[model samples]
Target: MSRLTRRRALRTLAVPALAAALALPLLAPPAQAQAGRNVRLLVGFPAGGGSDVIARLLAEKLKDELGGANVIVENKPGAGGQLAAQALKSAPADGSTFFVTHDHTVSILPLVVKTPGFDTAHDFVPVAGFATFANAWAVSGGTPAKSMAEYVAWVKNAGGGKGAVGIPAPASVPEFLVRLVAEKYKLDLVAAPYRGSAPMMADMLGNQIGAGLGSVPDFIDNHRHGKLRVVAVMGDKRQAQLPDVPTLAELGLPGFEDLPFYGVFAPAGTPRPVTDAFSAALAKVVALPDVKERLTAMGLSVGHVPGAQFGAKERAYSAAWAKVIKASGFVPQ
Candidate 1:
């Protein structure tokens, strides 16, 4: 008990306590405010596709919001989106890597493709919904069917077998819609799958496929060039760009009214704080006037739901499409 000895002991205890406090966060889950030094956004389609476009847009804003950290997009298109889903599964559960895609790859593909590498319910956590768009049912300009009714009748009377429908991203939302159309109208429509919308449009214009099903933007230019004819859209209401085109519900198919949406997700087990950070950043980006205007120009509607609600919406979409795909007798190829 000298004063110096007592002071030395106190200093020793104080140093250890300070070190422990600093190490606590390293052991605990990451905070929502901590953006990764680098981020990678995975797109389940090739470059130049709608999903890729959206991913890049968000990546740019995320980088700006996150102190200029590099945000990059990686496209892994194949297996009806199984490739990207699998890639996501292998990514660390940290917030750095995420997958951005539509309802098809997240919900529909699992139902069609047997044993896809990941499960939406168990393998991934919803981060945020970025935008929603409608699918357009269109045909090559040379086809005899010019309208929805005409297309239905043509498929019915073409020996119930000759004509084929091209679907971008088989086992996707558009493919399921094609199946529903065939069953609802009692037509024997054969389905042909393509890697992405661009390739399918090429085939449609070449008259290799009888008709095509994909996002409206995919064929918007083709329609403008007089190489494609939009028969109907799958939105609950008519699309602004194609106001004259009726929706499936308006055309007598009320059950096909769901608007397709695109969202971002991280692999399951990602920390909740990280998910919240991502969701919040996404909300900010979607709210930006320029971002909204740009996406709207591309035929996208800007909207976002919270992470938990987005997850529920994803599950609901999965169930709804499952019924449709089953009713259409679609088996995984």
Candidate 2:
């Protein structure tokens, strides 16, 4: 055929090719399963703390699981995790930003703080939850105490019936635990509140504080190294990492096995599709061997609860802490 004829034929085919290309997207599934938008994982505590570490860990792998969208960790440390929790209330109700926080911000702080800045029931929606952590009542290595019984006796003998135990946050589960255990065992004890676990562990290592009630991550390594002795853990069972360690229930503190949960939540107005997508990705993220290993090593029990169950768990936990706070006469600050 002539050059002109061939050129006319090529133009005729190009029109149909473009039309087919445009129709492909209509036939394809909605891209809702993969949150292609950028994601921010907010942490309410300083970097290197347990909450921060877990946030970073899950965020690191979660982005890949959610289709390689950029996921970054933003630290908004203040008011014992209230700042970050409050930010979620105003955050865009999309998959773009979410908070990775545990019970302190979700369940406990709101009940304990006079003005916590946000309401859990209305401000946020749980997406997925897992990794319940326990607070260990640990004593310094210099003290001659290997068990809860011995630790109580040691505090009684050395400090003249007055002893202090460090807790990372003022209005937290660990702080209330100090009061409850002291009242239960009839020991003269005070709760020394710290800004975070690092400072509390520092004092514990230097023997400035005779004992501490902090999460497993704060004291696990030291306890393993003989620098500190964990008297009793408060998780569902003795940690596999420290098989010899006793759980609070096993050590005779009944009804304390179920501890706090680490969860991800979005603003209350976030769409169901977005929240569900994140939860599905997170379920896979937590099931990863490396992810589970790292979290378990840091003293978290790897598990997953869908949004509804997680929300129920949060409410139940708040109710339980409410009783403890009231019993302790802890006026909210």
Candidate 3:
């Protein structure tokens, strides 16, 4: 039994060891890339708002794809979404936590709010876009303004002098659009900032505000209920839900063409592989017929942009909104 036999056995063992090492990644339980345990989709808005609706939709689909892992939708609505942005910054970047918010939370808030917790370009990574919608200008049924032309004329020559317009949040997309409209029409349009869309809708219904600017979905049902009248949409084209309502361009105001986008984002430093997996999952979910139909029914267009494209869009939006916010003379609260 000698040195030759012992050397032959050792060489035989080494061959299998090298092969196992080479195949380690392939055999590592599929890397748990789908969902690495508990995942939370954080929304920086109230439960009943449009952002929450999108988050809940994505959470339901993500839970199914993440191997039964719990996917929770946590609402941290405050400071115009800075609370949730800060929460995302503090969360572990192990792919378990994410932020789902619209362009206002990600792009406009930081520009208007002093020290808005996290930097959009530096502290967060885009996963995928959920949906995009345009803002609509609507008046309460009690208001005499039934169309854009009427609304502008009423604001300019009405007895109230400067007509007050209710906006969901100050420095948001709707607020900016309202300002642009006022400037365009030379109307004395005073902006009234409300906490959320619900309260603003209530004010509009109660006749406390002359008009309101917000997401189209916020007022579409009410408009159908005969409580409000949509004047113009801030989109390139008319929204399908309200086909009769012309866009701002059609109404001769083309500068208010910025469409708001909603997207999923992870805390910065999340692994690239994990982000990619999440993006792929989200793309699949948005593509589902039922999901698409549900979103369409809610007056949202089913436009799912990939991670890189979404990130670029977010950056561009930030830059564009920064200029708009600065020019509008909106100081941080």
Q: Rank the candidates by TM-score, best first.
A: 3, 2, 1
- Model 2's alpha-carbon lDDT is 0.83
Leading candidate by lDDT? 2
lDDT of 3 by residue, 72-171 (tens): 9999877668799999999999778999888888888888877777898899999888788888899988878889888877766774548888887777
Whole-model alpha-carbon lDDT for candidate 1: 0.81
Clashes of each: 0, 0, 0
Model 2, position 29: C-alpha lDDT score: 31
Candidate 2 colliding pairs: none
lDDT against the true structure, per candidate, is 0.81, 0.83, 0.81
**Where does candidate 1 stray beyond 4 Å?**
1-36, 152-161, 184-186
The TM-score measured for candidate 1 stands at 0.85
The parts of candidate 3 lying over 4 Å away from their true place are 1-36, 156-158, 331-333
**Residue 36 deviation, candidate 1, in Å?**
7.6
Runs of candidate 2 exceeding 4 Å displacement: 1-36
